[model samples]
Target: MQRRRLGREWCWIVRGGQSGGAATPAPTEKVIGMSFPAADHGWLGAVIKNAEDEAKAEGLKYVITTAADPNKQTNDIEDLISKKVSAIVMLPIESAAMTPVAKKVKEAGIPLIVVDRELESDDFTALVKGDNTGIGTHAGKYLVDKLGGKGKIVEIIGVPSSVTTMRSDGFREAIKDHPDMQVIVSQSGDFQKEKSLNVMQNILQSQPQIDAVYTHDDEMALGVLQAIKEAKRTDIKVVTGAGGHKDVYKLIKDGDPLMQATFTYSPLMVKDAVKLAADIVGGKTPAEKVTMLEATPITKDNIDKFYDPNANY
Candidate 1:
């Protein structure tokens, strides 16, 4: 495999032509191509690692690419199409930005296995991801119960994608019945801990009495916790997060009042996506066009079930 640095992104060329669109490769020369957004947080970092590890473990020829933005990811997918890989597995940076290229992948006759985020159109062969709306619903219900069905909530959202839209929509839907529950401040943390920390700090200064926080990702939740602790704020009773990070589980296990729960959105789902691509290459058709994984809630009551000391994310 040859690794090349293309500006901010990285592209690994295992075996393929340097230019031109996808072509029909011989059976023995077939390669599975993977394109993902660059690791912006621990969860995404684990996703990238799992995808690469799974592709290698399957004993399949593959090309992997990572991009920091939608435009860069678009280029990565185009390059993969040119490589003429047998199948393409992509975890899009943003839904709309990648949908057009996803259509192109389908036009080139390459089986596409979408992971995590969904494209605008159903162009992919298979999609493997955790239940995004379920995560938000679970988180909202938990916070509602914890705060006695009424609270001023602060929401730290992810980027502009289907994941963000669905999660936010589901959370609002869950809290809609309880008119007392209100979102005092909702801002994009962009799913990064440091960015979340900065955003949480500003929110903390602005909002004097926040009853709870509903963060879209666990890393962002951790950042929110840090901000709350630094400011010594006591009004915020609970902080709920999505994406099961081990650090958040530790807090729940230790009975931290603020760090109560997180929804299960494991990065290991990418492993399934890679395996699906390899399966498609091996002349197997997916049983379902979309594979939705469960998003189980993890709290202190069930912390033992998910608290893995050896886990990566």
Candidate 2:
């Protein structure tokens, strides 16, 4: 018997089988539900596409819901819960806003697999994410080496979440040892390109003689680069980005000194999250509760290894 909750009611679904050679048993049908932020950017678009492909490959009935904001995400999760999916995978829009809904999923006895930005509490059965801190730490190290550990840095951040917090913390921690290194100002780009372009424009107006720029996402980094080019400011020597974007790779391959490096934060992490949910439905327990992928630094020296023209973000 399979136990599932259907709209506040707990019921058992009976399975059919036979005694010795009585009849052939029918295959059990199970569905997996997925919820994620809408495809506002390239990385998220790739994540949504990858999840759909993976779910289909697993041969399971699946439904995917995307939300533009935290409130919509909460409603989507609630709807999925009401449907009593065998398992759920969610990439929350904002961690704090979705924490309560995550708890609800737990109370309803649904196996939850959290991807990317994590909830505030451990209300999930499994977590699959990238090494955000490593990206920041490595980016800081790269700047320290390039700039000789002393420079005026401007930081362009993403939305308010654990991802943003950890990356900021790690960068600060990395540059703490260098007394002369200074972060002049930090502003939120909200991980959007156009917004970041406007923000960078305002920043360029105020801060003169800026040495480098650190953007949380590659999309924002592209905007920052455009702003620098439009302003024709040659003082800024280095600009670093997170998340492996093909455009960034092309720039590096073509020897753009300013847009030199990016760290690997692949959107394909959602594939692992979906696979974990499938494993749970297959009656297998995850050996580890949290699986974190590594963050690798990419630069002109090794651009050939990662530069794929046909690759999706």
- Per-model TM-score versus the true fold: 0.92, 0.91
Candidate 2 at residue 229, lDDT? 96
Candidate 2 per-residue lDDT over residues 1-313, each given as its tens digit: 3444444433332211211111111235477878888788899889988987787677756767777888877877787788778888999889899999999999999999999998999999999999999989999999999999999999999998889988898899899999888999999999989999999999999998899999999999999999999999999999999989999989989999799999999988999998999999999999999999998999988989999998888
TM-score of the candidate numbered 1?
0.92
| Lowest-sum lDDT 10-residue window in model 2 | 16-25
After superposing candidate 1 on the true structure, give the runs of residues whose Cα lies further than 4 Å from its correct spot: 1-28
User: What are the runs in model 2 whose C-alpha is more than 4 Å off?
Assistant: 1-28
Write candidate 1's Cα lDDT for 1-313 as tens digits.
4665544434464322233333334556877888877776899889878887787678766677777888877887887787677899999989999999998999999999999999999999999988999998998888889889988999999999999999999999999999999998899999999999999999999888999999999999999999999999999899999899999999999999799889999999999998888888899998888899999999888899899988988
Compute the lDDT of residue 60 as modeled in candidate 1.
69
**CA lDDT of every candidate:** 0.87, 0.86
Error of 1 at 256 (Å): 1.5
